[model samples]
Target: GGRGGLAALRDTWQPGPGPLAEAQAILADAGLPGRPKVWRNRLTQGNLQLRYGRDARWYRFTRSGTEWRMDGPPSASPVDLAY
Candidate 1:
């Protein structure tokens, strides 16, 4: 991502899915604890908050996460990993 430091990490952050229900499925299958919440975001076409606890609304999936592509190992979307 063009951004660096924490911004870069935030930009590349990717979770399971955008929808709350779908994201719950991903987290459940992976034995992870989190939830996805939708918010009105002008910066991004949409925003999904994936996390639990007080910071539950902080976790998000950025554009870089979607752009990620790999041919080696078992690289898959968070949703794919859940299954």
Candidate 2:
């Protein structure tokens, strides 16, 4: 899943801005703010995670078909995450 798949979303992870609006929308619908202090990729295909707000917790995001979803409320960012 690293060759392409959702990994391509990193194209917006540059110094300026990122294309997380759509991804954020998913979080918004779940009552989670659409902002992140840090964004990182997961070795799992079509999966991503972020840390936001006052909590240093990490929330997992998964892609199903063409849509992205929140794995649940923010949990601690695991030490094993790829990035």
Candidate 3:
């Protein structure tokens, strides 16, 4: 329902080591290696998407065609949702 959310965030999103970068680093530290396409607080690699919540947690999402659906519960560590 909120496909444009990321785009809307672009104006306020800064280019630096924030949640997106932290999540990437977490995955790498956990030995799950792969760089995802990032935009603001969201990252996408293949059909999997990782979104950072305002609550300082990470949420996993899976894509089906053009829609992205939440796959499971949120985690404080991105590594927990790396799978």
Candidate 4:
């Protein structure tokens, strides 16, 4: 059997403070919606905790803000994208 989703995310996702910043920049450059805010924790496999506004939701890597489909998108709204 394989590790659970959260375990897999914790094992595979390596978003250092630097790389994470760069990823955000890429998102900004691509003009994608939603902001990558504070990283809560690896929620599950193929999903991560993205803080936006006063809430945090789990989102997959490929899912975009507009495609979130839920009442609110899953990406984070960090205080500073340059962080």
Candidate 5:
């Protein structure tokens, strides 16, 4: 069944588990890997902040609703997202 196949694919493609579990799941469904390292409070109203790291670089992200944008350069300090 087409619906069953879709559900199977969804289940198989889900992320294992980590810091940004929910966000990672959502991004995985959307074809992007989620790697949320830090959560910040930007001075802007109604904006959610996210910090992610990959390879050896960190990135600051700003999320407005479902949309996301990069805010700054990678962090110089090492962050452990597993916490």
Candidate 6:
């Protein structure tokens, strides 16, 4: 019931489709091709990935082989990450 417990709970919790739909809309508006696959807070399309941060920012990632690594800093808009 302390900080550790809260962290564990946050880790296990999955955000609903609101974030995912918002990201999709943003990408679509930006004219990005294809749709991203959602898992937890991440959206992956091809080698590009975007993660919704707890800080209300979208983070960019790139897939290298089987691992996805952070590619840049976080932004308040998913459009920035999509580009």
Q: How many residue pairs clash (N, CA or C atoms closer than 3 angstroms) in each of the candidate models, in the order given?
A: 0, 0, 0, 2, 0, 0
Write model 1 residue lDDT over 4-78, tens digit each, in one string. Answer: 223423333343444444445555555444443333210122223332112223233333465522212221233
Model 6 ranges off by over 4 Å: 1-13, 29-33
Sorted on TM-score, highest at the top, how do the candidates line up?
6, 3, 4, 2, 5, 1
Off by over 4 Å in 3: 1-16, 27-34
Lowest summed lDDT over 10 consecutive residues: which window, candidate 3?
1-10
Name the weakest run of 10 consecutive residues (lDDT summed) in model 2: 11-20
lDDT of 3 by residue, 1-83 (tens): 13333332232344456677877766655544455778777777767787776556667778889988778777778888888
Full-model lDDT for every candidate = 0.33, 0.38, 0.67, 0.34, 0.34, 0.69
Among the numbered candidates, top TM-score falls to 6
Better by TM-score, candidate 6 or 2: 6
**RMSD in Å for candidate 4, one decimal?**
11.4
RMSD of 3: 4.9
Candidate 4 error regions (>4 Å): 1-15, 40-60, 63-83
TM-score of each: 0.24, 0.32, 0.68, 0.33, 0.31, 0.72
**Could you tell me the TM-score of candidate 2?**
0.32
Error of 2 at 77 (Å): 3.0
Q: Tell me the spans in candidate 2 whose CA falls farther than 4 Å from its real position.
A: 1-45, 48-54, 79-83
lDDT of 2 by residue, 1-83 (tens): 22232333333233212323333444444433333333443223234554232233333556678666555544443332223
Q: What does candidate 6 score on TM?
A: 0.72
Clash pairs, candidate 3, are none
